[model samples]
Target: MSTYKLRQGRTMKSPLVNLAVRRLAIALVTLLIVAFAIFFATQMLPGDVAEILLGQAATPEAVAGLRQAMHLDQPAFLRFIYWLGNLFTGDLGTSYVNNMPIAELIGGRLMNSLKLAGVTALISVPIALTLGITAAIMRGTFYDRLVSILTISVISVPEFMVATMAVIVFAVYLGWLPALSMANEVTSITGLLKAFAMPVITLSFVISAQMIRMTRAAVIETLDTPYIEMALLKGASRSRMVIRHALPNALGPIVNAVALSLSYLLGGVIIVETIFNYPGIAKLMLDAVATRDLPLIQACAMIFCLAYLLLITIADLVAIVSNPRLR
Candidate 1:
């Protein structure tokens, strides 16, 4: 009997493991496709790297020599092959403009971006989740209506617009925070606040608004299920019913909502970082574009894509594992 039960447990676990493996494989394939697309897209950008680097006074012969030296004289396909091969070996190559190794150049910038994203997430998640759950618990009340209206309003505005307003209100008019974030100058607690303040606020407002809406939807959907209703009918307090019965079952959807909303940061941070002049990977990529630095651009693009894929893959795994049927 014990052996039969052990066999049954293994049988139930195998499908989930298989699904996880499949998901990982799909993510890898998707990443490859995305990398291919990113590589070719950058290749199509107008302007020659050799010309851009050499300036207008450069002779044709000089440009040809520079191209040859940089291996830009090679066919696009061969260059792409070489780039992709290096990518698998963790070699991001050197920047055309900076003439520095891409990894070394972007290391601090990537950390800055991560810091911004992390602080924004830390501030936004709990507030958004609390508001979402509260709004779900108070559905149809004036408070619920108010929360809904506010979240929708915030969501309707673009991040750049939001960032602009934040700069104006906080920096230009009030003069409370700096117009631009000087991340390198941070030293004391106050300096840290001054550095991260405006960017974090801009990012948080946008991220939280989306999270609140989705979290509310997920919770409310769970609340309407039959089991929750039955729990309430059996004298379980509404709060208790939701906290105990509804929330646990709603975990899958809630996690998915969080993941989807956070994914917005990948795109939104670009605008935020640019607006505030924050020293981050997005800003690095933008500068790289102006100089037609393909290696740097490709690396930044892949980092964003890989991060997005990771978030989505983790969310999928959580949802799969949380499913009662799968259990």
Candidate 2:
């Protein structure tokens, strides 16, 4: 019997590890596809930065020199093969604008983007879960209706509109927080809180608003499951029944929603980051767009795609752990 139990344990562990490996493989393939897409899309985009920099009045000799210098004269197929080789070797290329290594430029900034994304998720997920659960538990109560209406209202508004209104109400009028910049102006934690208050809250509300709907749906579904009824019949404490039983079951869809929201956040809440001048990834990508820096644009897009892939992969792993049916 002991040997049989040991074999069962190993069998269970094997499948989980196998699932993780499969998810990772899918993520890698997704990133490769993103790189290919970015390359072709950027190539097709009109306007040669080389010509723009050198001007149309420049001689053919100058044009040729610039093309050779930038490797534009290379055949498109050869360039893609070279690009793919470098990507596999972990080279994203130098930034056209800064002449800095792609890795170096993104390394520090990605952390800041991670910071904002992390904090935003931290703030949003709990509130969404709580409201959703409460709405489910209460069912037809006034509070449930109110929460549903409020979340719907928030979901109806765009992030940019929310950011603009937050800036106007909190920063422009109430003076509760600074309208722009998460820079070194905040020397203390309190100062930072005061500065981040509007930006964080605005993004959180916008994100959580949608999450509330997803959470409500998940929890409602969990409540309807036969196991929940069995738990109640067995006289399980309400708190334990809800927290230990229903909560875990409800978490799968909630996890998926959070992963999707993180993908959205990584694009950098254009309005929120812009309003606060946060200098996160989205704003950086926008700057890349305006300047037409092909390498930077491609690198940034690839980063977002890879980040989204990672988020979804994590969500899938979590779902698998929480619900054994997936295995």
TM-score of each: 0.97, 0.91
**Candidate lDDT (C-alpha), each:** 0.92, 0.81
Worst 10 residues of 2 by lDDT: 262-271
lDDT tens per residue, model 1, 1-327: 999999999999998899999999999999999999999999899988899899999999999999999998999889989999999999999998888999999999999999999999999999999999999989999999999999999999999899889988998999999999999999899999999999999888898999999999998998998988899889999779988998888898889888988899889999988988999999999989988998999999999999999999999999889887888
Looking at model 1, which ten-residue stretch has the lowest summed lDDT? Answer: 318-327
Number of backbone collisions per candidate: 0, 0
Best by TM-score: 1
What's the true lDDT of residue 9 in model 2?
Answer: 85
- lDDT winner among the candidates? 1
Error of 1 at 236 (Å): 2.0
Q: Give the deviation of candidate 2 from the true structure as CA RMSD.
A: 2.2
**Tens-place lDDT digits, model 2, residues 31-83:** 87777888899898788877766778988889889889989999987998898
